[model samples]
Target: MMKVHNRPQNRCFFLFFHRNGQNIGFAMPVIFSSEDGKCFIMEFCIYPEFRGNGTGKECARALLHWAREHGALYAELNYGGDERRCHFWESVGFVENGSDAWGEPLMILPPTEDVPITVEILSDPEDWQLMKLENGFKREIGENALTGEKQKQLQQAVKQGKITFFIARRGYRAVGMCSAAKCYSTFSCWDTAVFEDFYIEPVFRGKGIARKLAKAAQTWCAENGMSSLTVCCAPCDENMYQSLGFDVRLGTTFAHLE
Candidate 1:
């Protein structure tokens, strides 16, 4: 099952990888979900002589590009949990997310376009917006932790401008969000912002929504003349924050949740 040698001819599209007029390899891709714009890589091969030396990587990128041109919003492939294979695919922008029905690990590369997703700083949000925010809190605090009182407090905070939420939406549905809260900084004698409550719906992740949310929050801070923007994140998430221009390392933070 690792490779489908006998793919259905009518459903598969074959592609050849070439350089300098010489064929290097071939790939077979199937448009599995036309409506959702999803493609599955049925098979791929590189001639034994041309297996390494960056040839495979180059071909993989080209194949994905071709998939996108064919109207695929996402590309998927199944691979085992081999470290080398994982590293190779991840290097080319594929993220190992879940497993197929057969338990084969599935990897995906999200859509290329970051548009059609609008990020806005909300001063007056509708009921759907409040529901989405509550959904984020439910995920973070676990089931039943989002009590009625807590929901009311969150809505009140947003209404009073005690917190600002940057909501990312796909059409009318809210897909992701991040919030910022301002605090007076005695040391700088100015107000500063701490970004928090970053959340994206699981299915909509890896499509650059997080970056959009972060950018919106950062821009709002600048426009409002806040002195600085900071986030307290776990060591594992340091790289994610740093990538979004939070490069200055402030000392580690310890919190008492109670």
Candidate 2:
């Protein structure tokens, strides 16, 4: 019989797969972090005799399902920059997002297949969202975007409903984000919003995530009774905005105070 066990002190568990009372494979050091709802798959192995014809994939699928069922929001592992290994994990629905604190390459797998890229309005900025937004800003603007104090201020503003934050999530990770600043339009005599800081991580770009974020923001404006949503785009981005149903009516320029 196959035996299962857990090490509560270390928050680690082991899963063994067997057939006909013969051991086939095992996943060890399956660590769970309740603080972040992340499951860490440290090591997975199949016996030499059973290492063929989809056995590994099958075991991996089972392991992931178990992880999700046991309160794992997502699963992640380090792949050590191996192309073959990465491809194998990709086939099992893992995406190479970023690396770990140790600088090792990492991949993330969402809990289930139905958790497609989703965009949601952020009423409160969580740690994950703040981290992803910081990364997005650094990539797009070449500098840090939200510092701790700034984030505190932003949290208060978000709670007060002074602005809205839209985040695109691919499972447990925040892959993209944008914000809308509420304002009043004298011309329209109604409340309006200006969309800003739209960005998706480079790994997640070109997947229509940008459009989804924009659409969510637009929908929020409509549902909240705003007269319109506006975006000030550079000349290069004009076509992209047009594709998202934005019309160019005037040329504008800006100057930064010294």
Candidate 3:
């Protein structure tokens, strides 16, 4: 369904477009009442099944085009409470400005380019300090160091060829990590890999670091002769995974008894 509607009284307009016969989400385009009027996005959702196929980006480009055509004094959008939700805004050239009417955070999308990211496999002893720093940010950790045994265990795993941990860095500091382990998959009848701890610190969430780490992991998998790699993420992270060439799968959950 594709429709364009407006409320002349409130000066609000919406543009809805759904593709692939999936009528699951909404896309809102911005408009203004006058040349000096401001434009703000409410929210635009691309259904899970349709994400990462340029649908979201296409909608965002269209919204910006409409805003430009209407001579919007400025384009604004709510970033919601989580900055992760603002990744698309950042990718679309939006930067934090102020807040929208509902007190939700807002950003302005000026024409710009993506930021460069650097990722590498962790091998140096000094890099372990950065790993501990990253772990300190975990909720259960609260700035405390990992157990000494735990630290040694991970080191042994690295030495035994059991796991590979890739880290993303900003100059001298480690910003995030994605750890992978070789494993067997029954369906594939071959060796596969499992990835976990694909985390980016809150400060680094929207800078395309995740994609860089994923690329490193994919390269490692290709070289290691693995059939495939499995990554599990919160539903919120699906777009990042999809852009890295992952097929998102849905499933029921079960707990194992000890």
TM-score of each: 0.54, 0.59, 0.49
User: Can you give the lDDT of residue 190 in candidate 3?
Assistant: 92
Candidate 3 on 1-258: residue-level lDDT in tens? 133244443255655655666564665655545433456676677778767776778877777777778765456666764767777678877776433222334566542323355788888633554444345344222334445576677678877878888888755446578878998888888989987767665545777787888889988998989988887766777786888878756363456899
Alpha-carbon runs more than 4 Å astray in model 2? 1-114
* CA-lDDT, candidates in order: 0.76, 0.75, 0.65
Best TM-score among the predictions, by candidate number: 2
Clash totals for all models, in order?
0, 0, 1
Residue 102 of model 3 has an lDDT of 27
Total residue pair clashes for candidate 3: 1
**Global local distance difference test of model 2:** 0.75
lDDT string for model 2 (105-213, tens) is 6677745444589898775565555555555465355554456677678778777888788989876567788888989989899999988878776667788998998
Candidate 1 structure quality by residue, lDDT tens digits, 1-258: 323435543256878998889998999888654345667887878898888888889999899888778777777787676888778888898886544433355667755555488898875744455454555445444543345566678778888889998888865546677888999999789999999888776657778989999999999999999999999988888999999879999897887897
How displaced is residue 153 in candidate 3, in Å? 1.0
Consecutive 10-residue window with the lowest summed lDDT within model 3: 136-145
Q: Show the lowest summed lDDT stretch of 10 residues, model 2.
A: 1-10
